[model samples]
Target: MVVDGTYAKMWISKGILYFVYKEIYEINRIMAKQIVSQRLQLQNENSYPIFCDLRAVKNAQKQARDYLAIEGAYMTTALALLVEDEHSMVITQLYIKTSNPTYPTRVFTNKEKALLFLQDYKE
Candidate 1:
């Protein structure tokens, strides 16, 4: 993942390595590149889940929603999220609402609780 920011970090946990870059505004060129590259690198593994908290970021624009939706779709990732504010929930719902055919995402205020339910989730 390529990022022009104050900090770029990647955290690996439970087969999902989350790459977080400092937020940028007005353009999604850099962020989109990172997500696509990361997903490709994660191919042939277990689920590549992504958890994003946008409580303090700039997301007044509609592209933010599309960005998350695209990430979920392309990565086929099951998403788990915690929303501490309305702004974050707005973006979260956008992703949840999309509901891609290949990607199934779940939202939860409680991660541990959600995980327990997911353990028994069968389609």
Candidate 2:
């Protein structure tokens, strides 16, 4: 199943949930909640490894990051963040360092590597 939200597009394939952020959007707390809610709906109570493509995201507020790290982890087995540019990389790194997610989470510059990482956690 696939779902498109204000900040990103989400889909599930195999046992992985994919979230691809829209180009140049600033994510706030409310947006984070909405995104996670949508993801929960898509998953339908089944947990899955998540692959998030954040290459296009411009900015993410600290509240949003915190909410995602805590609340957004529902129905998620693990998380793989795909980043291309330095900006996205920094954001991903910051999220890891500051939020300290309970689930296994990693950042990758290569999509294939990210997928391979998430595959291990797929249900």
Candidate 3:
């Protein structure tokens, strides 16, 4: 199943949940929560790894980041963040470190690498 939202699009493949954030004006808490809920439903409550393609995302609000981190701690088994540039990589790293996420997390510039990393969490 695929779900399209204002700033993100989500789908599931090989038992993994993927969310691609579009290049938009802003990303806030509400949108993040919506995406998470949609993803959870798509998986039918079973735990799964998540791959987030944030390469197109220009900026995200603090509230959105916080909400994702907190909620993801319980819902996500592992997280793979696909980032194209150094800035995005740094920002992703900061969030992971600050949030102290429960799952294993990593940042990669290539989608293949991200998917490969997330495969570890696949059952």
Candidate 4:
């Protein structure tokens, strides 16, 4: 389900994503995000930011590209830094902190903090 608040995003169903790089994995993840984004398109949209969670299924990291590649989401870049710590650094965090945002896009660790930041953020 897409949790609505300050942080609008789709929650990846537990085990919905498969760790295998099989073709189905990508398709499934994409389909799931597509459904959620459509549901939570934008409403009373806040400048708070956008956050995506990749809590499990290591292969899902690249799904961010597919999810954000959408039209409105282009301005939406995500930092999956907090969602997972897969031996790699969170490049998206640096992107958000150092760069300027043309759109309402920002990603955080867990949904709670992200929601809080987006909900309470003052423009």
Candidate 5:
């Protein structure tokens, strides 16, 4: 299944959930909630390892980041953030370090590595 939201595009494949942010998009608290809600709807209450592609995101507000770190984790067994740019990588690292998400979360520049990390949690 695939869904297009205001800030991102979401889909599910092979027991994994994928979220790819729209190019140059900025995310706020409300947008964060909406994105999570969209994912929840797509997965239909089942948990999956999530692969979030943030390569196109411009910025995410602190509130959005906080919400994504906690509430955004719902129905997700693990999370793999795919980033190529330094800015996105730094932001992801900061989110992981400061927010301290309970689930297994990691950042990767390579898609294959990210998939491999998430594959372990796939059900």
Candidate 6:
């Protein structure tokens, strides 16, 4: 476990790093860096798929979203996001289209589907 806060919680499962945001909080570059760093330290791998549970996240700062969508690509083989609302889905899709992440990225309404999609990667 790298971070356990009122906003987000991070852990690993089956070699896949998981980040679950529990509340609405602005994600800045510093927070993104900490997330990537903790993922690296906890997973101890060159790269792996990330399953993000963003059902609770109200919004993410543009700079932070940009950094994670672009530079954070190197740390992840792919990204699977589970979003429960249309607003978040649209926001994530917009980021994907604008940032053009090198890695595969997808959004799902359920964690099961997201996990299944991420499982396709060898990691």
lDDT of each: 0.49, 0.87, 0.83, 0.39, 0.87, 0.77
Top candidate, metric lDDT: 5
Error of 1 at 3 (Å): 10
lDDT of 4 at 55: 50
What tens-digit string does per-residue lDDT give for candidate 4 at 1-123?
433332224432321211111122333455546544543444223222344454543343345544544443442323222344523226555544555444444554555655554443233
Which of the two, 2 or 6, has more lDDT?
A: 2
Model 5 pairs whose backbones collide? none
lDDT (10s digit) by residue, model 3, range 22-73? 8866778887788777777777878889899988877779988888888745
Better of 2 and 4 by TM-score: 2
Could you estimate the TM-score for every candidate?
0.54, 0.92, 0.90, 0.39, 0.93, 0.85
> Candidate 1's residue-wise lDDT over 22-113, tens digit each?
45443354555555565555544544555443323443335644564665356445555545555556766665676453555665555464
The local distance difference test score of model 3 is 0.83
The 10-residue segment of model 6 with minimum total lDDT is: 36-45
Candidate 1: lDDT of 9? 41
CA lDDT, candidate 4, residue 26: 37
Give the candidate number with the greatest TM-score: 5
Candidate structures ordered by lDDT, highest first: 5, 2, 3, 6, 1, 4
Consecutive 10-residue window with the lowest summed lDDT within model 1: 1-10
**lDDT over C-alpha atoms for residue 50 of model 4:** 42
Sequence-dependent TM-score of model 2: 0.92
lDDT of 1: 0.49
Model 2 lDDT-worst window of ten: 86-95
The C-alpha local distance difference test score for the whole of candidate 6 amounts to: 0.77
Native-to-model Cα distance after best TM-score fit, residue 32 in candidate 5, in Å: 0.8
Off by over 4 Å in 3: none
